[model samples]
Target: MRELFTDLDIFNAIGIVGVSLYIANYTALQTGFVRGQGYVYPTVCLIAASCVLASLMQDFNLSSAVIQVTWITISIIGITRMYVLGVTSRFSDQERLFIRHMANGLPEHRARALLDNGMWLTADPGTVLTHEGEPVDHLSFVASGKAKVIVADKTIATSGAGMAIGEITYLSGEPATATVEVAEKMHLIRFEADKLRAFVQRNPDIGAVLEQNMANHLRSKLVSMSETASRAPVPASADAAAA
Candidate 1:
């Protein structure tokens, strides 16, 4: 048994270990134990690929070496991409809050990915976000300031920061029921409806989160409207009859 164990045996053992690591990583990902896009997954893959390459050095096999090299390259690329995304998507406290209603509970990278689909812009007071009776082509989130919801030249509701604009129309596949006009100088993140729909289709998890957020937002709006209605004074004509 001692004679059977040589330097070649040790190298072969390492190669076997490397193969085991690679398979384990893949199985973990396939079984949903690990996220494929996460840092740890790719890092493990990189280490496994390196070990396999080292083991191949003892007894050169061109095909095995080539596979190991390719694996290493792919793992390195994945690591780099993960790192870059992490660095670029770090958000400030206020910024995170601004997007929280829509992206709450999402993985950091996934939240960042959802935010990347929109363009940030500053709008002056009176800027029309959506025209009444027009097709809804985009959705916007108010990061700061306020907007007025107008229908047929009458203001109906006021939307403040953290509120969603054009969401109702965007979801309903109908023309804008009201015109959304900036009531104060505002910063907003706007996403093209078609592009956003495509992205949602591609990433169902993010899409699910977004739908939940929208539902919550709508519920809050309904509650607010109900409270406002409850507090409103009755018209004098109606009061006169009661008196």
Candidate 2:
């Protein structure tokens, strides 16, 4: 029994524990219990690498020690990057409120990353964003002001700040169904469709959040259209017959 509990056994146990931590952390990230871009995941990785390095010191394997050291370095870099982003990308009070309401449960870091793929611009009234029957090459989020959705020279709907413009066409890969024109001086964030798609491909979590947000926006638009239809006056002939 004394022979079984040697220094070698203790070192092996530490290595096993370190490997277990690495596996557990990876599983947590894959299962969405933790975020890959967050500090906790990388910090856990750093601890795991440190434990592995300690076990390597007892065994004195050059190759294994080098690998563990590299792992530790990478983990440290990841932790530092997350910390810096968290500190520097802190939103203002109004921006926080707007993001909270407009983003619909998107994390701040992810929101910042998404915004980084776009450009902010102000449009004068009567600015045509998407022309009817034309391909939508870009999408925009209205930070302030309003837009008119028109088809065949007749207004179909009014959209205001917090609304996503060109999303339907962007998602469907179709030409614009209606012309979208700025109805007031507007602040907006615009993203070229190709660039946005590339960014989303690189960061799938952001894509998921964006898809969810667009779905919610579409649902709300549908609800508003339904309400408008319900409130419309019946035709004179139809009203007379009902009476």
Candidate 3:
């Protein structure tokens, strides 16, 4: 071990660090901790490439130098494209909200692509967003409104801004679990079910984020239902039946 350290110059140490970073980044990417299109992905790769190139100055290797340079160039291009095209400063108010809230863990460009597939509009009070026992042909994301979750004509819970409607049956191609009625006028981005499903199928990463968002929304709705149920008075019919 002491003999090995004898040849380990500063440049070799830098090279080792760079190799470690490469392995770490690849591991993280495979584990889904960081997305390939996200800033961290290319940024880390760029740093690793730079470190490797710096080490090559101490001990020259033509092939290794060429590879490192190419890696650095690709990383720079990726980073530049992400910044130049995914300029959040130019995004509209709703797009910003979607990015901040609904598009969790997705790259901004991919989020925008998903957003482009939908139609943004305002829905009025008493509007039926989804019908219970009917196919959910569309999914609505509530941007700024509240809706009642109705099951068998009883309002069981409320879904507010940042929640998705008709998500329960989205992936399964089943009937909606409950009807959703707009209790307050709301801004919504509506996506056609067929198109959304196809888009998701084609983009698995986006699909994964969508599923996560839906899961979070569903859990919140469940909590709301639990609270509402806890507050409800015992029905007179139940007492009468017991008597």
Q: RMSD in angstroms, all models?
A: 5.9, 3.8, 2.7
Per-residue CA lDDT of model 2 for 160-219, tens digit only, reads 877878888878999998899999998888899999999888887777778777878878
**What is the full ranking by lDDT, best candidate first?**
3, 1, 2
- Distance from true position, residue 229, model 2, in Å? 2.6
Better of 1 and 2 by TM-score: 2
> Which stretches of candidate 1 lie above 4 Å from their native place?
1-84, 92-94
Tell me the tens digit of each residue's lDDT in model 1 across 89-167.
8886646965687787676778888888999899999899999999989988888899988888987788888898878
Pairwise TM-score winner, candidates 2 and 3: 3
lDDT of each: 0.84, 0.82, 0.86
Query: Could you estimate the TM-score for every candidate?
Result: 0.66, 0.78, 0.84
**What TM-score does candidate 2 reach?**
0.78
Quote the positional error of residue 106 for candidate 1 in Å. Answer: 1.9
Candidate 1, number of clashes: 0
Report the alpha-carbon TM-score of model 1 versus the true structure. 0.66
